[model samples]
Target chain A: MTEGVVVVGLNHRTAPVEARERLAVPPDGLEDAVRAVLALEGVREAVVVATCNRVELYAAGAEAESLAGELRRHMHARGGSGVTLYEHRGEAAVQHAFRVCASLDSLVVGEPQILGQVKEAVAAARSAGALRGRLGRVMARAFQTAKRVRTETGIAEGQVSVASVAVDLARGIFGDLMGRKVLVVGAGKMALGAARTLARAGASLLIANRSFDRAEALAREYGATAHPLTDLGMLLQHVDVAVCSTGASGYLLTRHDVATVMKARRGRGLFLIDIAVPRNVEPAAGDLDSVFLYNVDDLERAVAEGGRGRSVATIEAERVIAEELSAFRAEELAQRSAGPTIVALRRRFQEVAAAELERSLSGKLRHLPEGDRAAVEAMLDALTNKLLHAPTVALKTAAANPDGDDVMRAARSLFALDAEPADPRGEVTRMRVQGEMTAKAKAGNGR
Target chain B: MLVGFLAAAALLYLIATVLMLTYLVGVASTLPSRRAATVSLGAAMVAHVTHDILRWVTLGRGPFAGIHEGLSTLALLVAGVAFALRLLGRRLETLGVFVAPLTLLMLLASQGVDAQPAAPLSGALLGVHVGSTILGTAAFTVAFALAAAYLVQEREVRQKRLRGMFQRLPPLEVLDVASFRSIALGLPALTLGLVTGLSAGLQEVGRGIPIVSWRHYLALGVWAVFAAVLALRLLAGWRGHRAAIGTIVGYASAVMVLVGYFVRGARL
Candidate 1:
């Protein structure tokens, strides 16, 4: 059988988010999307991971080059011609899967959510019957590799995002947010995201936006309280964590205002996360005792620190992925070698056993006692098993080693089972040619 | 033969420690690395048990006769308990990196203590005192390991660098709960140990040797630290980094009590 895995699509690195969004399928539509990709010619299996930042389609088939083209056409038909696509076949495809699952290829490397997103995509494809054969196994192995990369490497360590870093700093101040109050100074998207993160960490949310309607609406969504922007100082005294994001040109809270708030709070540590562009919270406020003020620059520094940590982990994860890829390739080759040959060998043996039984039953065995004929059939079954057991074991053992293809080819030809399975020599030659072509293309693209 | 067994067990523990550290460093793949370390530890445990059995049968005495034997047994119990925790799906196997090296040290420390044949004592109080204290110490070792992991994980979160070794560790809440649970389990054992030890000391006092000693005071110190830790945790909602640090301090005091015995050259 022809076998290969290929991934062809665009991500945030290759295409803009708008292009990804155009191609993006929601969770509910993922199954239909996977089925759509599977419907493309020459594609045996397909899974589409469509997140906000990326849209990737991974397909496995006997002919990778054609399948990649078909996938490109399918994506273009769905997402428009403007979407820039990248293609990875064979070992590269498997590596891409591992990296994607491990979150190394994410918009923000080491982010944890990509693994879950990939798993969800695979699940959707499986439910739709779009994932089958070696592709499913490959994806499953990818998940395991992803999990390994996560635990073994610091790839997923630290809070890389601005909002999450704010939440993390807040957590450092208060070990657990069980009954801690969090105040949102503005009801903008950044503030909303920060509030949601704090809320998820079990902090009580209170929204105070200049626009009362927006504050009330956002607060109602989170089942939180809404206060007027005029009462920000009073709210700060009551809350442990405060997130400020607004469109104001000047600093929202001066150092004096924060110092006053700290005095009223009676030495309770106040964490202020300022995510505004023009700087919402005063910089000098961070110097106050019991006040932990982190503006956009500070959050970026935290993010950069996390990025450095992940980079160190990424080197280790890359090494692990390389190891996994080699092992996976060997296993894939072994399975590909043994699969059709095993089936054909079993069929040939069964056929011979049945013919012998039929001939004996119709002639000499027909005259024997019923017990004797039954005994003969049982003997034949045992004989077949005994005859095949050694070769079956040997074939499987050879498949686990480097000389698997040679042994598989020898067994196929010796047993006259060459017609069913693909010629090993021919497959190897094709793979080698494809590999060389890919290398040339890469070298050319380097220019 | 017993020495051979001890050396082999120590070597196996060293190998397991190396494997665990490799896994902790994130260079090794997750599943195979953990499996290798766990198998090595299991083999080491088997070797350890064999050594203990041979020492007991050959010497015609209980396992806790000398500091040499007692330290070996203490390491075995600590490792066995940590292995059991691993089996319970606690995701605490990474702690083997700490536990294995410490266990090896404990086994090596046994070499320094003279292995004189212990006289057969004719009292149940002695057995209760020694056995309960050893078991309590094992429980504390496990708790200390968990507390150490909890603090490391807490630091990673507080610092905002989340990959590699940090990712391999159990979550903060899980480690916190496990640390407290180990302490909870240990406290009762320790109390029983202290009660039995005091009783045994009274019996000894009647025979002319003083009941109170430096070890006795150090034991009280261990108990006091744990009591304060547990009380603060239960009543005042003391959980997280501070609680973990307290657990470490408490375990340190417990270790110091053992050191007190070692320094005084006492064998009981």
Candidate 2:
């Protein structure tokens, strides 16, 4: 069977944020939770990524289907009872890992938070001893691919957030915003966010909402002054930029009000950013001389354009991940085969040496001194190496081939090493095998 | 030689103008077989330069003299600059559609007029006025072409609901600023040209002579329209489609003045 990784979970795709949140583990609890998952039956290694948008567990095992069911039950027991699950094994798992790390699977397609989330999850898994050789290598490759996608494409170019888009449109008209005054037309959260971004960018701010107290509170948060909606025209004359995101159903800035302001201001440019759903600025404001206006739809278009370019970069990133995962899988399968082959070869050599020592020591070595007998035992060890040299070389050669697993099973049976299995209940058995593999790999690297 | 050069140059410009129209109307995706549209425009510029040089060599004077030569040289300079900008990889091929036709019209109109050179001025003031005005008008021609492109792009976006085209065009704000800057550069040069022309006319007549011809009236009208455009751009902050329209109107009036001068003699 091909060595592979499998992940099963529901994200923004199969479950809403409410369902995802119920099953989410805090970052501090991630390592302990992943450790519990690794203790489950048939799970060899595992990593769990819990976020506001998703709660996914990625595991590597000889029996992926059984382990995936155990993971689903684990999540269900953790209060994800109604959450749906999607499972991907082998190549699909590799591609999905890359997509998640690159933020293509984000709530807001290219949000940049998913990469950090994935890295934190991987680090937690490693500390919990849930990430072993193959899965660890794959996760590392995924992080590198995400970095490549961010730097190579125009994917990250242009204003991506609503506030940035508002600021960009304002800059288009006024050329600069250092001393320009911006009036926020509502106390809504989006308006406050946009106002804050503008304020940070050096535009002087004024907040005007229908409720005087709420506007005053928001204005105080950003060190700005507040006004009521009745003073909008007065505010319009004083400020060069207006951002409106009120809950009102109709237009707040009417044609007559704008016209009156335009006449009063003597034709200085006015940039209006209307981020309300139904739009707070009148469409006709765009027709006025020196009045440049943009609505939510325009900002959405800018965001969508940026998302599309990022999607293209995501394709290149996924390809890199796939290549890395394949190389890691090949190395894993080779190591798995090498384990049984080396164990069997060692047993066969030890058996032959024991039989030869018994035959030689029975009469002549029995008459020697105790120190001389110890030297004779050491001499016998050097002789056994010369005896089993050909079979050892052949076993290693067979284990390196693509069909190495079949060759390994054959070697195990021929040498009768499988007569007794490594103790499945002994955790030390698996730990020792891992330690030996690391040592062998290190020795090979030294060569 | 001058007539032959002028005929060849006008024909080349007319062909380029048609190709540019084709490209602008979205019928041709790529320029026909000549590698790119820039090559066709470059060929037109070469023929245009040949026409200007032949006129200058035959008349034994710069082509900035009478109205016919002045308009022809202005048109040639505009096409040359536009072509040079394209060669520098500005993707200004769409602009050629608007400018080449204007250039061709000027060249063809020049063909029907007399080519008598201007009387030599005793002062360097006239030379400075003529050189600056021609360069300024050349800049205005480019501004007009950019404004026309912006208007067409904006209309396309509104009619087709193509958001992509909206992003592709220079922001309406940038187009407005460019139009204002070009006019700002052109207006002072035109003022100097008018002052020098008045002084020269007064010198020739030995007194204040009554300006009676249509050419003089057209020149004064073109200057007045540009003056109004500049004043509104600075004071009123007029921009976007309205500014684009104003630029087109002002440029058309300026071209008409050149045409009026070609129909009547320079000294009329």
lDDT of 1 at B115: 73
Per-residue lDDT of candidate 2, residues A1-447 (tens digit): 223477888875576434655676766889998998898888888899976567889888776668778888988888657767788876567668877887766544555667887899999999888887667876887787677766764344521556766665565445567887989997655567777788888999999989999888887888999899899988999898888877665678777778888878766667777765445677777777666666655554555554533455556655655665565455554555565556556655666677777777886567787788788788878877776676666666665566865876786668655554333454333443664576466434322
lDDT of 2 at A391: 60
- Candidate 1's docking class is incorrect
Q: Which candidate is the best by DockQ?
A: 2
User: Candidate 1 chain A: minimum summed lDDT over ten consecutive residues — where?
Assistant: A438-447
Residue-level error in angstroms, candidate 2, position B79: 2.7
**Model 2 regions more than 4 Å off:** A1-183, A187-231, A238-240, A297-447, B1-8, B11-35, B83-97, B117-136, B139-143, B146-165, B195-211, B234-243, B259-268
lDDT of 2 at B29: 47
| TM-scores of chain B alone in all candidate structures, in the order given | 0.87, 0.85
For A1-447, candidate 1 gives per-residue lDDT tens digits of 113678888875677534665675756889999988888888888899876557889998777779988989998998898778999887778888999988778645676777888999999999989877778888888999988888888776643555676665665456677788999887656567778888888889999989889889988998899998999989998998888877665788999999888777654567788765446787788777556676544554566555543567788889989888777766665555555556667666777798889898998768888898889989999998898888887886787688877887898778866454334445433443454455345324322
Worst 10 residues of 2 chain B by lDDT: B156-165
- Supply the TM-score for candidate 1: 0.49
Q: Model 1's lDDT to the true fold?
A: 0.75
